[model samples]
Target: MNERRRGPVLIELEDGPDTDARQGPAEAPREPGPSPADAPAIDDPDGPLPRPRTMEMVTRLIGRPPSRLTRIFINSGVALFAFLLSIAALDFLNGLLNSYPLLGWIGIALFAVFTLAALGMAWREYRAWARFARIDAIQRRAGSALAEGSLDQARQATRDLLAIYHKRPEMEWAAKRLAEHQAEAVDAQSLLTMAETELMAQLDQEARREIEAAARTVAAATALIPLALADVAAALAANLRMIRRMAEIYGGRAGAVGGWRLARTVMTHLVATGAVAAGDDLIHTVAGGGVLAKLSRRFGEGVVNGALTARVGIAAMEVCRPLPFIAQPRPKVGNLVTRGLRGLFD
Candidate 1:
């Protein structure tokens, strides 16, 4: 019986070997190994994510994480203390004024003068604000004309810009710069560079001076004013002045829309770069007890803000510049800070 089946068995073995050689034993049906979704989730293979909240950043800096209740209590205590201090300061001033009629009368007169001056300033600010729209319009028109490569239109735009500057002595530098290419048959980019160079070169010193002055003013106000809000108000005013001055210096005084846009952008830059908080940290580091501490903190804050302002001014320069700095090296923050700090202390 085995001899009779041998031929069939031999034939089956030969067919199996041929099938295995051709198809390689069919791969055992591959049990669908753990899917892609089942794999461990990975962090950004690129880099770390950004922190959104200021307080979150604060927690990281301080090392020890405080509970929500503790943070709330601390903030509440600070607010209460400031409020009580403000009330006491007001009461003290009132009692002093009551005791001294002459001094009170002098204070009244000074207050009236200040009120008038403030009104005058408000009127001037309004007028200046009005002029910004026209200024922005002129700049846009010129920029567009230049983009079209129309030399005549660019020259006309230059003339228009100069027309505004002719009456303002503060804009004499810009006027002079623009006057150079007012009639020249140059490309828009070249003309724009000349104006930027003239306007921005002088700004290194002027901007620092302005920021330092603003810092001093903030320090003085913080030292005298009992309310923390007063410090905020002073800083706001100072920033406005700094930005406005920068725009003017850069030969492109921004309109209300432009000013707001610029301010928003600059503030965003400060916050994003941690420049705003950096100033606070610097002040806190040098800060101690009493009036001197307050002044020091304010001063440090101002310096930090001023440095930020300088950065804003430099940014403004970039925004207003018609052409990129191909041949020249762009201004560096380190140099600006060094110069600004020197100017501030000096």
Candidate 2:
């Protein structure tokens, strides 16, 4: 057998007219295509618009007032339940007394304890409402004083403010300073402004800290929590706590029910003013225009939620503060967000 052609065979073919063997004019080296980082992002006709449904839902739930029918139903149900509960309790006590004397005595003691607790709670509720009333009265007086330039009314308002903050050791110096210089104020506006500058400056700082904390919590929850409605719940809770703190900072010292009421009031104000929704202007102002592109969807939502929370906190401050923001500038949502979320994203 012919030692099988072990060597490799080469075949040659003629090149077609289009197949240039020699490199022709080096096709003007295609300018290196833009890099992913440097290339302009393709503009989508339909942008990924942010939907802050969490804050929206929370605000709506808090802000919307109960309908008359709903209120009636709730009130009637509570009354009926209380009446039935009392009857049942009495029957239970009678049975226990007839059968087990010792248990009956124990039950009586428990009932007494419960009654005392209820009474105490009622008293606290009353006091909370009274405090709220006092704040409202102060606001009205301050507004009237400023409007009418009534120095007397201004002095009254200042006294009320001083009384509210009198127990706060941190406020002692501020109170003293106000008392000393308040007399120098010639008009109502001047007097109130002086009081605000002296007293509210510290309170304002504290309230801002509260707002920033709430914003941070809300942002973190929105960004990290994956469960449905969890972020909404967290945001609502944070706002409620923040509002309550705001009230306390401004000397409202709201109780449980009062705090909830104050939160509702703040939410109502926000909803009425259409501040619940975070717009592009707000996002750009707070986190800059590229935040959405640089961050994930959750992060973007977080930023928006945090900004809305700051807005709610500001509203709460306004509602809770006895004096209007006449002397001190109101806290801005952008500034609060920046401070609150400073290292969060980084």
User: Which regions of candidate 1 deviate over 4 angstroms?
Assistant: 1-127, 145-147, 170-182, 197-205, 215-233, 247-306, 313-331
List model 1 lDDT by residue over 1-346, tens digit each: 4654444433344334346565555443346678899887674333322221222222233224458999899999989997896677557557768999787667667757876996777676666555655555666766676578776666666666566656777768666766765556467666655654654355545655665555455444444556746655665566556666666764555555456655565555455656545344233322321223234544444444444444555554444443344335666444554555565457
TM-score of each: 0.43, 0.83
- Report per-prediction Cα RMSD to one decimal: 16.3, 10.3
Collision pairs in model 1:
none
Residue-wise C-alpha lDDT for candidate 2, range 1-346, written one tens digit per residue: 5675688788654344436556453343357786889876687534665566678788887888899999999999999999999899989998999999999999989989999999999898888878988998999999999888899999999999989987799999999899888889888998999999999998999999999899999989988899888888998899889988888888877778787788788877776777755564375644542356355878777877888888888888878889998969878888888899985656
* Alpha-carbon lDDT of model 2: 0.83
How well does candidate 1 match the true structure, expressed as C-alpha RMSD? 16.3
Off by over 4 Å in 2: 1-41, 44-46, 272-283, 286-290, 343-346
